[model samples]
Target: MYPFEITTPLTIDAAVQALQNEEAQPLAGGQTLIPTLKARLAMPEVLVSLTGIKELQSIAERDGQLCVGAGVTHANLAKQTAQYPALAALAVDIGDPAVRNRGTIGGSLANNDPAACYPAAALASAATIVTNARAIAADDYFLGMFETALDEGEIITEVRFPIPQAAYYAKFTQPASRFALVGVFVARFADAVRVAVTGASEEGVFRWLDAETALSQAFSAQALDGLTVPTEGMMDDIHGTPDYRAHLIAVLTKRAVIAAG
Candidate 1:
């Protein structure tokens, strides 16, 4: 890793101030950033560690929504988020024990890795991404591969997920990395249904509107019969082909719906 100064901030304001340096980067779980730094893929001059801030490590239900602190680790999320079973299940399956213990939801969403599991859940649940500057809707937060709508030096403080009537996340893992090769999150609401797809799209995580429309009418696996996602924009990598990922998108969506039921 490049020689850099690391700042441990005990509060959000201090962390935000530390990140004001143009070459400074926020360090949450370091699951992705550390590896990138070691490989010299990223060379930030300063690292503003957010873990020292106690306010960012909380998990609570507010009104009808689950308010999750960004610094909350995956293991803590999996254990503490029983109210949202689908989300807890997704957290439990994120990487392994070590990764779960070290990785933070804020870091995952901020990094916006196309294969990451949190984006699928956040998008499907229509959650809100609260940052130091403003609140961004999940639909507006994810821009593209490893990209987001966050401004420079903006810090994500919390994520607000509205409790769903029923929801499930189905992921087809790429065994070597444990990242989702093709993952689907299905959520049913009183007014509508939402289906989000990740790890399959070249453009990154996206809502499967066709499936959402179909599933909204009839929340069943059979409701997805004859439905197919175009392979044109699907990721084509050694682990899976574009066609294969597109196929898994459909299959997993069906499985998620069935399991959710």
Candidate 2:
């Protein structure tokens, strides 16, 4: 790993200020960041650790939403988010025990790995991504693969998920990394049904509008009988081809919808 200065800030303001320095980056759980550093893919001059900030560690429910702190670990989230069983179940299968204990929800969302699971949940739930600067809707937050709306020095403080009437996440995991080769999250609200697919698109996590429209009209697996996602922009990696991922997207979406029911 590259030589860098590590600073643990006790407050959000302090952490933000520290990140303003040249080549300084926010360090949450360090799951993705640490691995990148070891590979010399990232060489920051300073690592501003957000783990010490107490305000980023609380999980609560308020006004019909589940407010999850940015620093909440996968393990903790799996245990605490019983109110949103689908989300908690997603967290429970994130990685192995050690990775689950170390990886934070904020880290996962910020990194926005194309194959990551949380992005699907956030998008389907229409969750709000809260940062030190402002709150961004999940629809606007994710731009593309490994991209987000966050600006320099901005840090994710919390995420607010509007609890859905019913929801489910179905993932086709890549055996080695356990990252989703294709995963789908389906959420049914009072007035709408949202379906988000991850691990399939090259454009990153995206809503399957066709599926959403069909499921919104009738929330059931049978509603998606002929619906299919095009392979035009799907991911084509050694793990799976674009056609395979596209096929999985349809299959998983049906599975998720059935499970949600």
Candidate 3:
């Protein structure tokens, strides 16, 4: 690993100040950042840790939304399984115990790995990314191929997940890394229904418009029947072929709809 100065900033202002330094990078859980640095993929002059910020570690339900702190860990999610069952269920299905213990919701979304699960939930739920600068919509926040709408030196302060009336997340995990090879999150709200597809999209995590439209109307397993997502747009990798993944999108959508019901 490269030599770097580490700053444990207790407030967002301090952390943002540290990030303003040209060579500094904000450190969340260090689950992804540390490995990226150790592999020599990233070399920074400073590490601005968010661990010391007390406000970034809260989780609560308010105004029909679950406002989760940026520092809330997957383990914390699992521990709160009874309250926010869907989110917690998704959390527990993440990586193994160690990784889950160290991974934070903010860290996961900020990294925005193609196979990551949090982004799917955030997208499906139309959650808001509460940052030091502004609140960004889940639809607008995710860019593409490991990118997001966050500005340089900006910090994700919290995330607001809309409380869905019913929801389910389904994924086909890689046996080793436990990363999603193809994952889908489907939710039904009083106003509308939404479906977000991850792991299977070549463009990155995205809303499955067709499936969402179908589910919004019927909200059933058969609502996804005879539906076809273009294979041209889905990810084709060692895990599965493009056609197979396209099919999985439909299959998983049905499963998630059924689970939600």
Per-model TM-score versus the true fold: 0.99, 0.99, 0.97
- Which model, 1 or 2, shows the larger lDDT? 1
Candidate 2 per-residue lDDT over residues 89-200, each given as its tens digit: 9999997889999899999999999999999999999999999999999999999999999998889999999999999999998989999989999999999999999998
Among residues 3 or more apart in sequence or in different chains, the pairs in candidate 3 whose N, CA or C atoms overlap within 3 Å are: none
Q: What is the C-alpha RMSD of each candidate to the true structure, in Å?
A: 0.6, 0.6, 1.1
Off by over 4 Å in 2: none
Whole-model Cα lDDT of every candidate shown, in order: 0.96, 0.94, 0.89
lDDT of 2 at 128: 99
- Model 3: lDDT equals 0.89
Model 2 local distance difference test score: 0.94
Q: Write the per-residue lDDT of candidate 3 for residues 1-261, one digit (tens) a residue.
A: 668899998988989998999999889989989999999898988999998899899888889889999998899977864655777899999998999888899999998998899999999999999999999999999998789998889989999998889999998887877988889999889989999988987678999998888887888888778889899977777788999988888888888889888
lDDT of 1 by residue, 1-261 (tens): 568999999999999998999999999999999999999999999999998999999999998899999999999999999899999999999999999999999999999999999999999999999999899999999999999999999999999999999999999999999999999999999999999999999889999999999999999999999999999989998999999999999999999999999
* Candidate achieving the largest lDDT: 1
